[model samples]
Target chain A: MSMLEKLQPIFREIFDDESIIITKQTTANDIEDWDSLTHINLIVAIEKHFNIKFALGELQSLQNVGEMLALIEEKVKKNE
Target chain B: MNEYKLKDMIVGLTQSFSVDITNEMMDLFLRLSGDNNPLHIQREFAKGMGFSDRVVYGMLTSSFYSTLAGVYLPGKYCLLTGIDVSFHKPVYVGDRLTITGEIEFISESTGQVEMKARILNQKNEKVSKSKIKFSLLE
Candidate 1:
């Protein structure tokens, strides 16, 4: 599946919104009810799925989808 | 909804946990949000702002509610369908916060449950309260 296809379920599960459609530039502010706790829940779900643990700094530094994709790329490379 | 089910949850499930406020914990939360409110970073600024010292982030206390949900309910049990939170008072450094929650309502068919959550200081001062709702399953 493409990255967007993969990220869709993460959005749906974390925000409990099956209607969520995440674009490359999607940010938390774009979605209602995407608060901090839910953000952590999303992080935990993503980590579980990809089996990559995120550093506190990486999690804190993520501002949008581009940053998330970059971080995922870096994490995937490190693991490889 | 089974009256016995709600009573059983209240009697056997609800629990309370306490955590003391510290500068380290405060700074961790501040760092996470990049919230550098001088009132939270400096004692004099806090006092000047009518507070004794740095106060806890309102969301920090709210997060504790998640801790409670994760522990008592466990796993996806906290389908936590909905929630509404309100900040009532400020938590200060050195305050011992006791987070307490109780089951208020349950609808088995609808798969919805309502809970009342509260954060109180050692002195029993209410710091925050919320009406939280969750689903028993997906």
Candidate 2:
């Protein structure tokens, strides 16, 4: 799958919104159910899927789908 | 993104700690925040208003979520990037609080980590609920 394709699943699972179609521009305001409580769950799910962990700093900086996709590529390269 | 070798920073990470809201602590919260809101500082005001005693600051309890997110979860994580919070109910002075954190998502792609979090006061009342969005590094 392409980078964006891989990312949409993670977003969908975290927000518990299967209909969630994450675009590069998608943000917190775009998702009706997105909130602090579920945010942590999203983090955990992402970590498990990538078989990697994110530093707190990186976790905080993520702003949108595009940013996350960039970081994921970086982390995958680091793992390789 | 701040990355630590888990073991090194475990001592202070996600310290899933809790404290009973003692009368003294309530006083401290009141004094520190200068939130002498009659509903929280005066017994008469509290009782007449239908509360047992002066209540504690909603933030005091919500802060536990901070400890859980900024500290634990990923373990040896970076400082929190941003946080969003909500106060649901009144937190009385003598309430017992319980807070917890568990990792559900760690995205290697965006360096974004998300967790499920909440805080509840003694009466099993949910005092605050929030979804925190933190980024890597500073």
Candidate 3:
């Protein structure tokens, strides 16, 4: 499966909404439950799902789903 | 109390201790929490329900998770974030429970740590399991 497909369920589960459909332009502002705490939970869940770690200040630069997807792709490719 | 700082904790660190459930604990829990459930207070009622004896309140037994996080794991700077718990076996009054917690994940950017914990009876049967999350203030 593509990385985005793998990530979709994580978002859906975290937001407790099965209807969530994320795209490159999707930002935290698009999701009702994507507050600071859920943002942390999202990061933690994503890290676990992908078996990757984010550095301090690295995630501070992320603004939307596209950036997060790109970061994960880069990290996963580097690990491989 | 443990004075562990965020930098001092690493994944896989573990802490364990034992506590006894007593009549005074049951009374204090009933008086303070007002949980007068017959299943937790009346042995006869519990036996009627097929439980061996009056079951200790699940919350009372799980309350040790607070002590595991606040007093042991990352003691001084710990700020609890969340907990997910499941009770597997009925815990009775007078049971000695051993609580064990092991660090599972740590997010430095979020200042968060997640640990997996379990409460085991003296017979080595698991009575409860939980995942606890906390943030470090420092």
Candidate 4:
């Protein structure tokens, strides 16, 4: 499955919203519940699901879901 | 009670404490929470429900988790961020509960520590388990 397809469920579970449809341009501003606390929870959940650990500052610059997907893809590739 | 700085905490570090559940504790909990459920407040009701006596409030039993965080594991620097807990068995008044916690994960970048903890009664049966997370304020 594609990265977004895999990430969709994680988003749904974290936000407790099954209707979330994420796109390349989907930013935190687009989600009402995407605050600092949930951001941390999202990062932790994403890291666990992808089996990748993000170093400090690696996620600080991400502006949208597409960037996050790109980062995960790169890390997963590196792991392989 | 012991105070631990952020630098002092390591993965696998563990702390254990014992708490004696008493009538005063139950009275205090009732005063504070006003949770007067018959199972918790009435011995006859609890006995009819098959428990040996009045059941202790689950929250009261779990409240010691705060002591575990604030006084033991990471100690005075702890700022609890979250807790995920499960009640596996019932706890009753007059039980001696031993609470133990161990650091499972430490994030130096965020100054956060996650601990796996459990409470066991005098009978050595686990009554509750928790995953507690806190930020260490340096």
**Would you list the C-alpha lDDT of every candidate in the order shown?**
0.71, 0.65, 0.92, 0.89
Candidate 3, residue B130: how far the Cα is off, in Å: 0.7
Candidate 4 residue-wise lDDT at B131? 97
Could you give the CAPRI-style class of model 4? acceptable
Candidate 3, A1-80: lDDT as tens digits: 88889999999999999999999899988999999888888889988888888888898888899999999999988889
Worst 10 residues of 1 chain B by lDDT: B1-10
- Each candidate's fnat: 0.00, 0.24, 0.33, 0.05
> Per-prediction TM-score, please?
0.56, 0.53, 0.96, 0.92
> What is candidate 2's lDDT per residue for A1-80, written digit by digit as tens?
88789878888776767888988888778888777646655655666677666775676777886887788788778998
- Cα lDDT tens digits, model 3, B22-109, are 9999999999899999998999999999999999999999899999999999888899888999999999888999999999998877
**Best-to-worst ranking by DockQ:** 3, 4, 2, 1
Best by DockQ: 3
Compute the DockQ of candidate 2.
Answer: 0.17
- In candidate 1, what are the lDDT values of residues B1-138, reduced to their tens digit? 112232245423465788888878887988899988787778887788897677677887788878766565432346555567898888987889998777765443233456788889988989899877665433
Which residue pairs of candidate 4 clash?
none
Which of 1 and 2 is the better model by TM-score?
1
Per the 3 Å backbone cut-off, how many clashing residue pairs does candidate 2 have?
A: 40
Candidate achieving higher TM-score, 3 or 4: 3
* iRMSD values, candidates in order: 13.3, 7.0, 1.0, 2.4
